[model samples]
Target chain A: MSHISLFEFTQVVKKTLEKNLDPTYWVVAEIGELRIHPKGHCYLELIEKQGEKIVARMKATIWSYTFQNLNVWFEKITGTSLKSGMKILVNGEIQFHESYGLSLNIRDIDANYTLGEREKIKREVIMRLEKEGLIRMNKSLELPLVPQRIAVISSAHSAGYEDFSNQLANSAYQFHISLFAAEMQGKDGTKSVVEALKNIFKEIDLFDLVVILRGGGAQSDLDCFDTYLMGKAIARFPIPVVTGIGHERDETVADLVARTRLKTPTAVAEFLLNGMRSYEESLLRSYERMIGHTQHRLLNESNRINHAATGIKSLSHQLIRDVDSLLRIQQQHIFDTIQHLQKQNDTQIDHLTGRLSLGLKSNLVRSQQQIYGYEQFFHFSDPEYTLQRGFTYTTIDGKSLNKQEAPTIGQVLETMTLDSTIKSKIEEVK
Target chain B: MAKELSYKDALEELEAIAHQIENDEPDIDELSALVKKAKELIQLCKKKLKKTGSEIDDAMKELED
Candidate 1:
């Protein structure tokens, strides 16, 4: 309690440190807090830690002129902004002030060391996930063929989420999208994203995949994605996770473990729409092939049918001609038969008539000859014929001499001649 | 008399010969000559009738074929 003024004590400490500690010595420390002053200076609280406890802490400053150039060079090389939680190798001088207390004036910082430290932490996260067998877990899940149901993890008003939904809508594919709004940067980023993922998992059956999206921003803003818990969550998710945290240069641990890593949120949308488009194109190709094959077969069949019909038609015509000619020949045969029968009838009638005439003539001649012989015989036997031959006979009283005993003297005698008749009186018998 | 006379003409000549013998009172020489001519006519008629019948049989057989 017997001390001089605070200024005198601060002066004594500052001189002592300037004499003992080397000027512009390089020191390794972590930035526990960082801020920019209105006067264009950078202020940082540097710390050395063992786990969550800080064993050493120091106030450090970068002059505005140095900070302007240094900040640009660091961000250009590391693709990250100077931010809290970053391990840095810096060259600086230690000094003490009466009003403000002890501080370090940083003249230079090695951006590569900060970048390498971040890379080392990212490497450790990846290794831990790998050892737990979670690195390939989400990747092994089969992405749905369509992938239309999407759970989006992003800030509510971010252009990243808008670009993704708009991209899908423009593709004209129906998408079932649900927004799980979350802070995507700063202190609450990792925790908020993890919470969104948890919420999505609560209704896992409803979503085909999850999308973690952010618009292009300071590379350091993506530092939250490099955390072990963030990487682990993505690696172990039941559904596939797609990352589109838009940073041109650096890749975060979350990006590495996600099922798909795209440079931007719009690019993620394109990837999904392109996959569906290719699938649809393949189906269209198969349909065209089927139609072509069917039409080709039908054409061949029609040609064969036409050929067979032509063959049948020709054969039918030939058969008809053959039948018609046969009918004509039969008709001529029938006509000839009729003419021959008529001729036969005429010949039979003529022959029969000649035979009848011959028979009648012969019978008439035979009868006439018989009659002539009979007439001759009768003329020889007649008495009138004998008288003409000089033969005579006498009668008495019209009786023969044989009829009377003797001729009486009074009886009259009669005589007959061939041409003349004799009247005689019956007297005696001859 | 024509030797080639048809059957009708030959029979008519035979009848005429009989009538001359009966109605004209011919002598024996004339009767015998007439009778001889009638016999010739009758033979010719019989031969002609037989030829005609054979010709008709051949014609009938040809028609059947």
Candidate 2:
């Protein structure tokens, strides 16, 4: 003992730990602090967590050869930069030196297995949210047209948020919009958005919708949106949600649950505008139809009037001929009754003529009333109207809708005039 | 007349209302009715916007910490 150096003492201790442990592979516990040495070496300090017990602690090192090779592979395969907060299962040999303290030299690292373990943890979190049935809650909320009040979960400083805000503001359609700024990605993002949702729910009635808008990124970077905490919060939100996260190419759980899923922030604006246009189109179509029908009815009534006038003229001519024939009959009958017979025949003829004249007058009045009734049924602007008031209508599928139906580009539309049909194609829309 | 609106109905109606208001020629008689509807919609919108503002305020407060 007197001749032994500090290293020699550690060698005896290392031998004791190796032999007494009697473990082919020992499982140890520690709060590992990883470090990279200037000499291209990786180091870790494993310490036990307890009440000042310091139950065990050890130093471990991986040479440059192993560290560099493993790091490159890990980054390439997982698409994640390897760093702290990651626990790794390592294999190596134990050694003790007289000058240096005890150290474990790492030989191989199973990064694949570590990645798998991380995925398992992620899956567990997802499953928990799914089981709670909160995943679809936010999306189930109905989306408002020009959604006025929106809780936006996104990074305030991010370009995506700016794009969303600007696009919404500059939209052809106007909405009273508000933003609930949130962290949209990274480790802190999920927590931030969750908190935002909680605060929003406290005054739930105030919001028409919530929008989760994140910009496109690498696939691996998209995992944060797919996280359980974020998904659950989005699902359980009290209002309708619109998601403009990433691109149309990739689908997120948030997209699935949202009331509307849009590819980008600009697309979200388009969706709202389109919804508003549909209603406007319907109303316009209704107005057009009202005018069209009014004109059509007036035309039908005019045709009826012309036909009645022709019939009245023919009847008048026949009546005139009948009066002449009656005068001749009066003369013939007068001989049978002498002077008394002629006077009686003339009186009888006058009575019959008066009855025929009254019938014609009543027929003219009835036709006039019928025409007036038709005008009232349709109720155009004026009782007596003409067709040249620039009336037009649009039809799709042989049926017409009000101004509310704003058909998309390339939609076949038929615009009808009082006397013509104009077929036009929608060349472009702003 | 401000059409009676449920939450879902209000959203759908509002969408139509916004478009109709934007595109159609203003009818003097129907304008009052539409304006009344728009006022109610503004209320709904205000309520929603205020809620989001509050949430953002809360988040900002937390970030300040």
User: lDDT (0-100) at residue A104 of candidate 1?
Assistant: 89
Model 2 — TM-score against the truth?
A: 0.47
Regions more than 4 Å wrong, model 1:
A1-6, A296-430, B1-65
- Interface RMSD score of candidate 2: 31.3
Alpha-carbon DockQ of candidate 2: 0.00
Encode model 1's per-residue lDDT on A156-197: one tens digit a residue: 878888899899988878998999999898878899999999
lDDT of 2 by residue, A1-430 (tens): 4588776777788789878753434334342677788988988876665775767778877798888987777656554544544545667676666567677777766666656756665667667767888766765665664466667777666667777778767766666665667777656767877787787888778777777777645434445566776777677766777888865434555675566788877677667667778767877898899989989989999889988988888888898789878977887676566867756866675565555445644654454454344333323322122234776656665555454466678877787666887888777756
Chain A superposition TM-score, candidate 2: 0.52
List fnat per candidate, in order. Answer: 0.00, 0.00
lDDT of each: 0.81, 0.65
Instruction: Give the winner by DockQ.
Output: 1
